[model samples]
Target: MTGKIRGISILALLSALAAPPALAQSAAPSTAQPAAPQAADASQLEEIIVTAQRRQQNLQDVPLAVSSLGASDLQDRQIRDTIDLIQHIPNLIGNNNVGLGSSNTYYIRGIGNTESIATQDVPVGTYVDDVYISRQNANNFGLFDVERIEVLRGPQGTLFGRNTTGGAINVIMKKPSATAGGYLEAGAGRFGETDIRASMDAPLSDKVLTKVSMYRNRSDGYVRQVNTGDKLNGSDNYGVRGAVRLLPTDRVTIDLAGDYVDENEANLINRVDPATGDRIATIGITQGALAKYFTGTKANNEVGNSTKSWSLSSNAAWELDDLTLNSITGYRQTTQRYFIDSNPAAPNPIATGVSPILNYSLHQQWSQEFKANGQALDNRLNYTVGFYYLHENNWTDLGTGVGTASGFTVSGDRTIKNTLDSYAHYAQGDYK
Candidate 1:
């Protein structure tokens, strides 16, 4: 064991590690204190807790630049999706392209993808709880039942790994609590939009608790199809999430979560902006067919999309005397298809064989993470060390058939598949 190149001993650096100046926090006790807790007053400012670094801390205490939206902020602002969030946050923008609603493009600090292609990975990293979502297309998520959303600006190589080169976002869902309570909600909006949501939390016993939440949203598409003269672009979506908490012991906690989203809507098409009353200019398309791009135009604008996604995750934490160990495992999959009429106009005898298509894609991802976080030297030092592994597989179907109004049919079809596997080990410490 001794026949090796002489190396510096890690022990020699012990004196170099300085501890930060902060009060050490004691782990949560098993039994509640006999004294009743004081109620917080709404009129007074409250403390905001965040897990941006894989550990809970006051938002103001974190060293990095961060922005956060809480559940109340989301509801009061009517932010149902990340797209909606773009309006409130600075230096953020959402792609104006017709998107199916699940994974839309977003720009943070001018870093993001302009195209909606599922294969491209955007620079902004997104995480659900502690699980990292690698691909940009998978970052678009519904904002229902979310506890908080934290946007961390700048590179995060230590905790989040490569995908956070631009930045990172963490979406935290409300987990099951040791309580028996529930609520129901419903709302209506313009454009035939209606939403219904319900959630219930109950205790299975003293050691186990569970919670389930679901919502259904429906709205009329604003555009009109040429063939059926039916409403074209609109909203139709629904999603549900469920969670369970196992507290077998005071020091050990386990959380299991599963959720699914189904989105069905017409493919995004060129249309006149309602507010501006201006017809959208077509690119690479003839001027004569420009009128067909209007939302209510009679050209056969037959297009639609069906997007489905689901995810499962487990988080286990063991609280020790001065530290916490966490294990997070996750699996996610998505399937989406975009259907469009190659010829939205009347089929001409000359171009009878042409067909138009956007793209169909399938993706699956799985990851595992282990983290150790805690205080050292009587709360003077804060540190986090973790390992992460991620694997992804994606498949896409491409259709090619270019025909003028003369009716050109598709001449070729192609398929592509990609697989990726990567892992990382990282550690960081803050000593005051």
Candidate 2:
């Protein structure tokens, strides 16, 4: 089936090239007028272009409720991931689970998923370079080298497929340019903090252009694990992206890109006294038992977790007479593992010789998408239509074991496997 689709895609490319020159000449007018030529107030209403309906259109011309954030806004506001951007964008909020890296939930307009299970569904969809990212663990993939981010409000059922009841976030990364240039940024703040980002783009030849970007971030925890007298919460994150643009001729362009990310850290901690619902005392708990037997300590309980993710994408475009054709294909994979301590007690009250409660979990997922879109009828009737498929597998194990106290052993496990395949076709027109 995959081979057949590839062959069909190739045939479509050839047919587009064979289209009549008259059509090409007609479509050429749109590109002739660059966006910069017509501008309103440069600061208030910047000329924003978006692929909301799969074609670049003026932001104001689109009826959908949408907000766009350029690179400058992201950096200025310290927006790092979907979680950090939620408060900045109107009507968006996200919460990180206590000990589960796979269960980060996002709420848009008060609609979202609260469950942390890997098999659970989400109302808001997240996409990077036109590829859908279904898992929350992949959400921390870093936002360096991004060109712009578009948040489309309201249900995008007609175009974005299932699980978009609330809205969708589209993250567009900078494409490799024919010119050679790049930037490097480094910053430091409180709590043993450090951030490094770099990107470079150069032309390999007349037909090929390449771009590479990398980022690294590390910080010392603000909270201390009283049990072990060690830093309880902090993070180490790094990723790399590489893309190649192949433009054999003026009418055809192909872009291929791939990225990988790794994130590690000591999980979060929460301290509570069941009797008083207040802070508990940590006097005798040792470091070895805290690291081996307990998932998380009182200081940063459930907040410490780690994730690793990677993805690849390809975009091919062909310009014909009255219409332009585009094919976007992408795949992503992610793995997340973390542990949390649900309960902490003094004198090991819960158990005779064991710690309180320990919880551990792991999640893995893979997703893919293929879409084709363009405009029609003298560019007045713009449209986007495509088919999407996804398959995900999840494994979760929760366990509580013996601590220095006594008689504390409990465990549970759950596994889920899901596959979704869908096909959709949509068309929208503009009078002006």
Candidate 3:
């Protein structure tokens, strides 16, 4: 739903947090089938492989209720980011309610986290290339050169461990291709929106392969400021990823990958009356105070959200006679800064009332996991066991200023820090 204010489209009046792109061979503008390999029989269905149980198996063979989107599925459906999965995955919901450009709040079966604080944990765990992402901030990443996306629809504590009480989401990136091939894509949308995406795959040798992918997008704000003729509720963000796959031998494989993302977005806008908590009038002489404030002119100090993050990971596997041994190690860091102009509608800048809120966060974490999977009893029994370790530290800084008729006050800035160290051994087995 949308409206217009003085010939300007009110694309987004609720908050500057406006939310929710395109393609390649799997993402071309054609109505082609998904990337899953089809069975030789014409009447047979395509075989969809999944790692929901920490092992590759036919999607239907897995007992859990799973939703899988292959590369072609994502491209055909235009599922450009993490948030877009909600539309296609049943009983799933996501949004950028955290107010950060690259942040997200996801709910699966009505269980999830809404706060962006560093101390709290998200019930719904998120993973990329088998590495866990502990923080929700900057988790809303742009999807490029993806292999598949899997959403597990129930408690996954057995295999995923803590924070999986709700469920889990897995993003499997496209590994370096054996053959040399890639694609480039560009797109445009309303409100001066534009984006570019590209990926390239190169094989250095018979045993070495490498690939890189990147994307960037920008759009004008939908909510227009009549005074300055500038729009609010806009975003500018970009990300890049590089991967290398080493096939030391037929029975051993190794993968090394790293990625970085940056985001800058407009600040949140007040669209409702603070006193009565009613919708502010955006039209005519009866315009509410907040609406009038939006139209009125003032000093332009566009204090918004700026976030930057990066990570590196390595994964290796060894295939034995009857068992598969795997190890994964990862390290990640993030920094975010944002501010809220509490109130500029006050009659007096220093006395009548105004409060400004500012926040800063710095976080980093590292984790390692070793696991083994195998089957016995004439292939009727399947099992997996793993040991995991993790360490993380976070720092948060907060500041605020208040104004009143009597006097003005500025609160001293404060910082909060938290650190965590965890270790556990888990095992799961299934028998027919």
Candidate 4:
């Protein structure tokens, strides 16, 4: 595999480790039981705010359909990644094809792209901290210190720049708080699983604050490999994030954050089928005895995978008497690699041997956005306008090895390149 393809494949594998469960703080009430009539006051109601249109507004007041999941809600559901979050969001579905590594496809409102090619962009747009993610392979970035996740349904052609035909997901990470505090959590579960997470926030100075966070997860495989007596479908991952906040003045603020993640694991499992509807007690065949029937001498194939990634982002805001200016910038790079059996001995070809496919891919992306919003016509109406830019590059390598009884092998290589750029201005108004 080429260097670029190898890099992307590694990134894909690493992303799986970062997948954090979706936690929504507002999905349920603080108390387990219903409250008394007298307690049902305005103060008792849960308030949900969203920025689907690049401006903060009450979620109920927005015309578009959207689902807002808060920290508490996410925690309650035990959600730890986009795949799990999709289950809670109506009209959305996602699934990972086993043995395909992290190549997952998402469908929104019954529309989505299933092809796993690096050159093809997802019909839906995914954003973290208001920064657009151009490549679908990068969607596995874990959720850490995330304050909220907004899944906007329907086409968002006006505000979001590209690939918004289906919808958009907005991941808002927690900002550095002025308060000094931290939290650590660890958990162990069935299947030789363990997880560790740590986070801390401290005031660097009177006007500056810093935050750091990290997590690690590991699990034993659930599937057993008969050939090597090894288990398949296990994973390990680690990642860190750092942030610095600058409050130069009361009306102006700047925040800079960066994160990195690494992961390695054996992914996917395959088995031989006797073809007959009824089960059979091990087809009577020996390794060397079946060598002639097998075009490839290889008896069994395995799936191995790995990935790594790094990202940087900045969110700055300046406030004036009647207007606020906001700018967001972000950059990310990732790599992924994996091996799978292209052809398995099944009902059609029981005597034929298995052929393994080796594939690798890489991806790098950068994006920037600027927006200005203010009240107009004596505060009776609010307005917003913005500009956006994004760039992405990727590479991939795919080849298959056919093992013959004679121990013969052959392989080939394929390459791909892609680029996208866009600019737009938008304006919105609301009457209160």
Give the best candidate by lDDT. 3
Q: Which of the two, 2 or 3, has more lDDT?
A: 3
**Candidate 2 global CA lDDT score:** 0.68
Model 1 off-target regions past 4 Å?
1-45, 96-98, 116-118, 273-302, 340-357, 400-406, 409-412
TM-score of each: 0.78, 0.76, 0.79, 0.78
| Candidate 4 deviation (Cα RMSD) | 14.9
Per-residue error for 89 in candidate 4, Å, reads 1.2
Displacement of the residue 143 alpha carbon in candidate 4, Å: 2.4
lDDT of 1 by residue, 111-151 (tens): 77655555667677778988877655445666778899998
**lDDT digits (tens) for residues 80-157 of candidate 4:** 666677789998887753344444567888878875666777877888888887765546555667788998889887
User: Which lDDT values do the candidates have, in the order given?
Assistant: 0.72, 0.68, 0.78, 0.70
lDDT of 3 by residue, 283-316 (tens): 1111122222221111122445678899999999
Candidate that beats the other on TM-score, 1 or 3, i.e. the better one: 3
Alpha-carbon error at 374 in model 3, in Å?
1.0
Best-to-worst order by lDDT is 3, 1, 4, 2
Model 2 lDDT per residue over 40-143, tens place: 56678667899787678899988888999989989899887556777788988876654443345777888888655556778888888877777665564578
